[model samples]
Target: MPEVKRKYVTPGELVGKGRYNRTSNVYQIEDKFYSTRVGMAEVINDSLRVIPLTGPYIPREDDLVVGKIIDHSAFAWEVDINSCFSSFLLAQSVFGRDYSPARDSLTKKFAIGDLVTAKILAFDRTRDPLLSVSGPGLGRINQGEIVSISPTKVPRVIGKKGAMIKTIENYSKCRLTVGQNGLVMISGNPEGIILAKSALDLINHEAHTADLTQKVQDLLSGSNNGEKE
Candidate 1:
């Protein structure tokens, strides 16, 4: 087994050589590999990859995301998924045959400024993302304030097996829906909402630090005590 090197890398920097397969945001020339983006490099076993610290969210199929309605056409509505590229939710995808432009207005169904939780149906670099609200846990979000964070920090917020997020919910007494695109919807008491937002901010600020789970736990515990006193 080869030792995995974990470190920050810059563009054009050598990642690894020979027998290591390169993946995501890196380029290869023969057996030698180089990074094409600025990120942290992770080498595990025979696989090597880069995790970008900053970049636009590249949509992937089946990704659950939170978005705001930005614009609408006769048959579809455009959504801002906190990415450089916008997504489209077709009328038929949401309303099926009940969507009738002649008798019903698209705006009335999904007006601008409405927040939604949707699933990506398809995505390619050349085309806008296709979204759907037909699955479980997918639909219009009527309440709660949305908080934005760096998309790269989503995994940290989620933590191992959802430990970190569950901690936030318990401490703040807020029910949260976290989107992979870095949008979090908080629903509960005003004080709990504020505490949840603060915890999320802490995660975003210290995602790269070690013992992050412990740090988030300590923060939540301290806040919970303050609320009781």
Candidate 2:
């Protein structure tokens, strides 16, 4: 009856089932003839993109993430970026040098519990994605603890690119990276980090909600108001 933005569509049925009308980026409900976006829904005939409520974190291309230094070695530091598998950050990829030769690395710059801000360089069907901290204004993180969430929910936090994150940053008085693969790194005063993490968790939980922007605004407003009183 009414046309809406493309993002509003939900999953329809399994893919390749030879059912449902294909239109634009969505499949339509044969009965209602309503078009919907493709993802995380049944396609009737084709396999759907619907994921379980919870699944292993999968990394996609160009995901910005917060990396937690878990273990260190002579060559690279091991980081858990909330991916299906943890990733490695080579010393060369980062500005600070543990050393040179590529054989003996210095892990002192990063250690267990320290969080680093980085971006995914490459992700393939197999093997872990390579990450980098070499981008402009990007490098080893200075402070704060990393917060993790469902990879799918990352979009909600980032908000149609970077708009959503900018709001959270302004509201919480914290700096953060909403990673492509759902890895979030929060840095600021300890209190700010905690507040940022709380906001992140709520966004992840309510990703499918309508009026997401409004919901987040309300959440932040309530929190700030509570602090003042």
Candidate 3:
């Protein structure tokens, strides 16, 4: 595997050129790639992409996100997805063919303040994004504490091939469900949940550091040792 070179860049800063191709949050002029936003530039295997350091969550199809129910209409419930745009969870999306908003109360099924894990079915800048909770691992989050972090740091928390998250779960002895929109739900032993939250905080604080993985491991190890003593 190639070592990825990561660096922070400002708007219009040169990201890469030549063999490096641009991805999200960047632009190209001829052969030169430049960042269009304030973000971290990542170069991996001939591909270069900039991850925005600060911005609202841009909804993409099939993204599993954690959302809080804020309001409801006769046919759909409004969800705050930790983004500038709110999402809509329709009654039909939840109940399929049996759904009848007139016959059934939408609030009865999902009340305000309920945290839900749902998928983005469709998203359009002009209209509110559509969401669904019909898939596996997608539903009401009844147990667990929700932790919020910067959306850009989500990938780092997950790590490559889920190694970082696995490490956190093992060390904390907690079951974690991470949403792309920066909401994480931790469930298990109360102590483990606290440890998990602490681990996530460390990851968020040092996301730009190259040795972040090792630092996280060290942090967890120290926490575990304290518990033993």
Candidate 4:
């Protein structure tokens, strides 16, 4: 396998010249791939994707997201997933098939201002995304401090094969639940949480850097009692 390299790219720039097994944020013309926006172009193995430096989180099916309950209707609760489009969590999803608006109050399960970690059940260009909290580690975020970064930086935050997150969690003694939509829930001691947030900030600003994982490890390992410098 060839070594993967990430490069800054601009709109209409030629990203690659090959058949890719997967692609994102780039259009292909024949055997060439052209970037669709200003961002970082990455080619790993047979996959090619341009991680846009600036953009809203586009909803994709099965994306884990942390969202805020902004409003509620009779049928569903509206959640702000930090995207241009709001998402819906139906009452039936939480209350079973026989749920009733009068008998089963939506607010009872999730109220305004509550944060939840959910999965994008379904989404298409035609309708608002649907959410489900019916899985392991998915539901109202009752604890932890929330930290948000650019959605595009999520892949970098997770690192290659979970190295970055593992480093932070192991060194800082914090558990990080990162959302594809850019929201992060850091749960641990106060000091550990502070250190974790600092690491996340560093990753967000320096995602394009090649040695970011090492930098984050240094940041975590060098912190004294998890105090911010």
lDDT of 1 by residue, 1-229 (tens): 6777798899999988878643777888998889877788888887889887777777889988999999999899999999888999999887787878887788878899999999999999789999999977788998887999888889888888998889999989998888999998888999999889988998888787778888778777774455531
Better structure of 1 and 3 per lDDT: 3
Q: List model 4 lDDT by residue over 3-93, tens digit each.
A: 7978999999999997899999999899999999999899999999998987789999999999999999999999999999999999899
- Candidates 1 and 2 compared: the better one by lDDT is 1
lDDT of 1: 0.86
Model 2 Cα RMSD, Å? 6.3
lDDT of 3 by residue, 1-229 (tens): 7999888999999998876643777888988889998988999887888887776678888898999999998889999999889899999887677888678888788899999999999998788899999978898998999999988889999999999999999999998888999999999999899889989998888788879888789888884455421
- Please provide the root mean square deviation of candidate 1 (C-alpha atoms, Å): 3.1
Best by TM-score: 1
Please, what are the lDDT tens digits per residue for candidate 2 over residues 157-220? 7888788888888888988866666677777887777767777877877777669788677777
Instruction: Report the backbone clash tally of model 3.
Output: 0
Clash pairs, candidate 1, are: none
Per-model tally of clashing residue pairs: 0, 21, 0, 0
> What TM-score does prediction 3 earn?
0.90
Q: How accurate locally is residue 194 in candidate 3, as Cα lDDT from 0 to 100? A: 86
Lowest lDDT 10-residue stretch of candidate 4: 220-229
lDDT of model 4 at residue 96?
92
Q: Identify the runs in model 1 with alpha carbons over 4 angstroms from their true place.
A: 1-4, 223-229
